[model samples]
Target chain A: MYWEKEIETMDREQLERLQAVRLRETLERAKKSVHYGKRFAEMGLDIGGIRTDADVEKLPLTTKDDLRENWPYGFLACSRDELIRMHSSSGTTGRATVIFHTTRDIGAWTNLLARCMYMAGMRRSDVFQNMMTYGLFTGGLGFHYGAEKIGALVIPAGAGNSKRQIQLMRDFETTAIHIIPSYALHLSTVFTEVGVDPRRDTKLRLAFLGAEPHSEKMRRKIEDLYGFRAFNSYGLSEMNGPGMAFECPEQDGMHIWEDNYIVEIIDPMTLKPVPDGEEGELVTTTLLREGMPILRYRTMDLTRIIPGPCPCGRTHRRIERIKGRTDDMMILKGVNIFPIQIEKKLMEIPGVGTNFVIILDRADYNDSMTVKVEVQKEFFGGDLRQLEALRRRIVEELKSDILITPRVDLVEPDSLPQSEGKAKRVIDNRKD
Target chain B: MISYQLSIFAENKPGRLAAVTRVLAKEKINIRATTISTSDTFGVIHLIVDDPARAEDALTKAGMTVSLSRVLAVVIPDQPGGLDRLTQLLLTENVNINNAYGFVLEGHRKAVFVVSVDQIEKAEALLEKNGFQTLDAEALSAIEPFHYMKY
Candidate 1:
């Protein structure tokens, strides 16, 4: 059940000691780079004063805007020649945030991913089909190397091409897959179109889902449709994608591997650590990354440390699945609404398809939200009254959950806008 | 027997109908009659096409939501009260019409009034019993609206 048994079950105090040593080493490496070097010097930070991982809280939180303003090399902790690979966010919203990795850094990331997979029941005998996009985006290569390290036959079946993905699964007898949650839900329709019930026709037994934060209901829906144990993967490119934290077989919450990184949950407003079980912004500091040392990076992702110990015996503390990114929240009429909240409610209503778009508009000094939901083809019937009722029900349910009635438009399946690999769920047309 | 019409879901925006028509025109499916029912932001385009199954398949492949709905295509007189007579009969039979559209095949002689109703079987029986002629899918698709016009 353990990957690196000694490290996996390391005593909490011992782990903190190891983290302190790594934190110092990381700061040392970070000082070598132009970005962190200047900041550390200007702030008069004494790396020697850091005795334990808890000392990370004293350091300032690094934001993505800092990474962006610094651009390509601001966050690099090592020399340019020391870098072996780099992965970046899409940068659609702003300047792309890039994370570099040295060879040792790559090796470290691979080991963590391998540990994550092993904890989720992946083994050497498994044939892993990685469905994430391969280039630039870290989701593909991170898991690709990790699955390979586990001695699994790695099928780097990149994203999309659902038909070919299915054929390859059957042709290669693939037993495991890594995919985004939305794409996984979309692929189920293609499975039916090709007369392939994944549960019966494919050898798939495990799925690792990530890249975007999806609700627990979304995970269970994919699990039921694919007839496999779906594991929730948590990671951002800043924290070495796909391996930051992962769900064990218990499936209660994701165990953030504290061995490689130190984590904190803080209120976004006060910038102070919240209670252990309270939901707050996740601030992470890389203890192991060498190519780039990000110190107390304000992840902007919102989640909480689960209060109790997990059944899975690894002492690494677990975190509840990411609720939503602080960046993804929208304030409509003074009430803050996360797209995930609407999604969580949408998933509960049967006949609502997986894809939806939240459009915000302003007119006459008042803000209005319109949710365009894709109606499942199976539920659409000849009667207009039934469709109208579905529309009203969607609006009513969303109103009760979101505290405001949003105009719900029932659209055709696959009609909502999508960009890159992830769907552009919200279109904020309101001008300030 | 009840005939079928293709009902398509579309956002209320320019070029939506054009896109639908382009798919039908590309597939060589002729439209016999069409009507649009719209709400605030979206609408449904109900079409009596030459072939509904093929139209549905083509439109769905083109990424449009299309459904086949049971409708009665009754031949009525081309006079002013032709539609009123049919609706009155439907009202008398307690058969509510969800959607209805009509087109004249031959002026002053015959016209077709198509209606989508909840109690379809009952509507068809009442219409037939009341000396009204209901067209089947083949006859409905074969209709040439305004073919009698010399213009």
Candidate 2:
């Protein structure tokens, strides 16, 4: 059943050969790509010269602006007929940069996702409720196709309407749900709103969530209510989709399918790859992609790579869950505070409500940060003095973490703004 | 019993006033009289409601900053001499007014004055003995189907 040796566990020598051959094909393919053609030539680099992975760092890295400038068809390396499916990024200011996938490309992605799901202890007999939407976003279709390819019965439920998701889980006896961890919390919230106990009612055993940064404190919260193990899935829309890698049962880190893709960590500032185990931007080159091939594309995500045999018996290289994003880092008083650190702290305080806003502004010459946290009035004694004291406690909590004093503003229950899409955690209004 | 009136802080923005009113309206709160004291970033709105506790509860739910302090509500005659009488009484008692706002209680035969007095219970007893009417802390917030804002 594992005839896919090129994807499983190929030795270094064999991998080098496959990568060398595939990389050449990718180079030729890139030369003809409308976006890369003149640019590659202007950069004065020969695609034929790239004989090894070390040769990749020499090529100019692709940026998000490059994709936008080229727009929909610029990055297409193959004809339309060969490409069976397409996906695009959300929030298009101009034209959307469409991602094309051929049948083989789809197969490779499905296999990778299946392997990720498999690592999380999913089975062919398991009924997976696909909660992510299937459309222009890669998250939905990527996970949906992967589940079906694994011989599992997949429920294409998509997202939103938590009641329907819960009902289907109970009716279909859903064993695994493919959704982000934050959305699963929304499900538990709905259960409480409707007076249904999630612990006693839900049949969900495992939840796979991605597309945004999360924290381990949030992981424990989801596990506590949904009665399931929450696994973090990682991927980018341009990088194919949610199957780039996934957390295994041991939950140490996500395992990248080294056989099908080449993973590297590079210092985004220095323009050189960092040594293994150092935190840097992730770059990937899909060895098997036919229609839309990405070579050493800089994925702005930051995490350290662990190159070792996984406890799950898979020889793939593992990566710790993303610590934070490089672009999201805010420099305040010469100190850096990532939104992820706030998320971790927020999760530690239960019933603090999911909605919060980190107001950022300049106080004096230094940067100021105020976290406006929402608390249920029932928790407070309806006294402003008492409420102010609670605010002080939160200020103390965050001060210990950020090493800088922050003003804690307490708002009423359900007072914080609610978002229909991703929760807006940071409201940075700094001059920078 | 002595009662205190408070001027609470609110962000200066659109819909902020409406939001504050909606909370009080939901509870059938009666704001006897009010005035917004504002600055560049925020504003403090001094108010006398019919039911202070109920209004405070509602405002708290809506996430409004509120605080309580003793203030004097003195009754003045409807004639021009009414304010003269109340001010002279406070002056004689050596009570200084932090601020003052006057509003005629509709359908009432007399005018009412809200005074940020140094002492409230003393003024209330003095004004009552002088046959002047002064609203209590609860009465100030209990404005029914309010004439202006359903306060």
Candidate 3:
């Protein structure tokens, strides 16, 4: 029943043995590249001496800065002629880190995606609609090839155009779809406006939501609204898009494909491995990548590994849903908070809309946070007292959630900026 | 009783009022009587329009929060004590006026006073019993202020 039954269900001992072999090959491949080769020679590291997964600690950690320093082809282990595709980050902060793939690498990625989708109960009979952005972003094509590999009829619908997305679901009788969780929440309103209840009208039964960090409450919200089992998928462009980990049918935690990558949870500050079940930055080593192998690439995503075995029988260890990216965490008034925590609280409130903007500024020699939320249109019809109550409720809820009382401003529905990809929830204007 | 006033929730910012007016203007909805009530950061614009439902729809579709509230329109003498007499009469009956605005129909003779009270039926009954004439939607829409002016 498994896509790669033997590889996926191999016992822990056997899987580690396989990882050791692949890890050696991966190191060898990295040594052929300019970036890792110089570093390996300069450090006098021996690729052959590294026998087990634990020995991988001997290698220095690779950061995003390392990837950018090398840039376009610095990490290429294969010749340019063998490279078939490349995907780069949006590079909003700086230079984009581009990951290249060979024909064999593409096949492996496709198989992992198919395995992820299959573990989540997708089958050949299902019609899959990919709702993420295509090109550059790995989410679109990553799931695309996987669904197609599983023999599902793939509809690459891309993103935005909510009305047409609904129309496509109706026309094609789409049974499965992949989308960002926030966009899915935003699309539910459009479905209501178009008068087509997604639960009643569409054939959608499964949704693979990822590419942004979200909370469990948000997942339940999508499931309740869309009438589907919303599975959380996790991956980064550095880790081959979205096939890195996925929730099995049990839906407790995402099963990280150990056969494909070496997963390590390390204290982001010390760069040392934390005990299992402890939250820390995820460092991954591409075990099977050919075009470029990133060894011990610090993902900067904070999550914990579930220590117990999954009932799904996949020997691949499971990682908890990403709590928050280290870079996305905000500190206000000596309190550390993530935007997802605020999102979880806001989604719990009935009248608060899905889109919200958190603005952090300096006021009166202290940090001030203002959460600008969009009030649902239905709540606007209520009297002034009701509106006042809603504002007070939001302020109280947020104060209890983030431990800091924020100024709450309720604006009109759809007033906040709607993100087509990667919702920008925070704006820090405090002059550092 | 049929007359409706579009009460809009607006923030106290430049161009907010202009935005609402622009939507009505685009819809070709004529504003009959307008009053703005403001607090520190927010305000409400209560407007008597030629078409209350259509104006509400236009403003709402333009992303402004609007509600159609039924308000009482009473006829009062356009004199120095016109509003005072109305207020004194309401005070005698213990009717509380939440909001009220007036405009003269004919100089020094008659005027129209629009009032929003906590209890509409009681205030209407009290006003009618006192012989103070109240206008319905039909009469209010037909009011032509400054019609006697040459310009």
Candidate 4:
């Protein structure tokens, strides 16, 4: 039942031995790049010292800033002709981090993705509908080839066109779909609007949701709405997106492919490893990548390594669902709040729609937060008093969760901005 | 009495109301009485149309959220205490009016007060028992406030 059965169920001792060999090869490849070669020469570091998996700490961490400073090609370990594909990060914050992949790198990524899909119960008979942006974003192509590898009828339905998406599902009897969590929730309304209940009308049976940090409550919400099993898939573009880790039928935590990536959880402030099962920033090292093998790459995603073995019988280690990115955290009134916390609180309350905006502004020398949420269309006919009561309930729930009371504004449906990719939940206008 | 009102959820934008009207006009649906209640960012347009079912289908098919709710249309004298009299009677019966709007049917003589109540059947029975005239859907749709206007 396992993809790459020998490697997936490899015993701990053999897994570590394999990791050590791959770690040595990865380090050797990393040093071939101009960036790592300069660092090694300046620090007088020896690549031969990385003899075991535990010795990976001897290497300094690679940050996104390093990739940005080097720009287009400083991390290239091969000639331009050897590189087959390049994917750049969505530069929402600043400069985008671009990574090159050789043809072999593409093959390995596709195989890893196929393994993720098979572990989640997807088979060759399943019709996979991919609903992410295709070009630069890794989510689209990453899952595309993987589904194709599994011999599924792949529907390359890139994001947006909600009506058409539903039509496609109905026309092709789409059995499985890969989509972002928020977009899945947003599309649920479109299904209702088009008079097609996804649970009743389509032949969909499985969903792979990822590319955004979401709560368990959100996962259950999607599953309940779609009447199917929604498995959480975790990945970032730096590590070759959407297939780094996947949850099995157990549906507990994502079984990270340890054979491909040596995972580390570290305290962001101390830059030291945290205890097992403790929450910290995720650090990953690509063990088999050829074009650009990033070592000790700080992913900035906050998650803990799940301590025990999964029920799925895979020897690969698992990580808890990502809580929030370190950079995505917001401090208001001296209280730290993650947008996912607010989302969890909102999704639990009935009548509150899927779209919301958290606006942080300054008023009278004090920080103020306003959560503008769209009231579901069914709730719009409610009287003013009922709407006011809903607003107060939302405020109370948010206050209890974030330790600060926020003004709640109930807007009409489709009033807030909709994103086809990652949903932007925060708007911080407070000037530093 | 059964009176139908089309309730539409609208965002607060410059041409949002115009868009609703444009749809109704295109469908040849005549609006008899209307009320707009707005919050900071959104509002609801309650319209008493000539054909409630047709208006609802047209608006919904045009991608607007529309609901047809039963309301009460009470006839009141076009005088100083007409609204107060109707409201005071309903207050005595403990019936609350969620929304109400009125338009003069004849100069200095009569007007129609359209009200949405929590308990539609009970409010209608209470108004009729108190000797107040409640117009049905046919009577409501037949109202033409501009009949006395001279060209």
> Against the true structure, whose DockQ is highest?
1
lDDT of 3: 0.84
Residue A33 miss distance in model 2 (angstroms): 0.6
Candidates in descending DockQ order: 1, 4, 3, 2
Candidate 1 chain A — worst ten consecutive residues by lDDT sum? A88-97
Instruction: Report how far off residue B111 is in candidate 4 (Å).
Output: 37
- Compose the digit string of candidate 1's lDDT tens values, residues A1-432: 899999988888898888889888888887887877788788898878877877887676899788878888977776789898988863222245788899999999999999999999999999999998888878889999999999999999998788999999999999999987767877888898889999999999999988756678878888999999999998888888779999999999999989888889999999988889999999888988888889888888889999877777888999998776778766554344678778888988988987899999866434689998988877777556677888999999888777678999888787776433777789877653
What does fnat come to for each candidate?
Answer: 0.49, 0.00, 0.09, 0.21
lDDT-wise, the better of 2 and 4 is: 4
Which ranges of candidate 1 are over 4 A from the true structure? A91-93, A329-432, B1-151
| Chain B TM-score of every predicted model | 0.92, 0.79, 0.89, 0.91
Q: Rate the local accuracy (lDDT) of all candidates.
A: 0.84, 0.71, 0.84, 0.84
How close to the true structure is residue A361 of candidate 1, measured as C-alpha lDDT? 85
Give the DockQ-based CAPRI class for model 3: incorrect
A359 in model 2: Cα distance from truth in Å? Answer: 4.4
For model 3, residues A1-432, the per-residue Cα lDDT tens digits are 688899889999999999999999999899999999999999999888999999989987999889989988899998999999998753222345789999999999999999999988899999999998888878889999999999999999997788999999999999999987767877888898999999999999999987766678879888999999999998878879889999998889999999999999999888899989999999999999999999999988899999999888888999998876766767553234667678888989988876899998864334689998877766665245556678889999888767678998876667678845777889977652
Q: What is the lDDT of residue A189 in candidate 1?
A: 84
Candidate 4, position B33, lDDT: 76
* Chain A only, candidate 1, TM-score: 0.77
- Which residue pairs clash within candidate 4? none
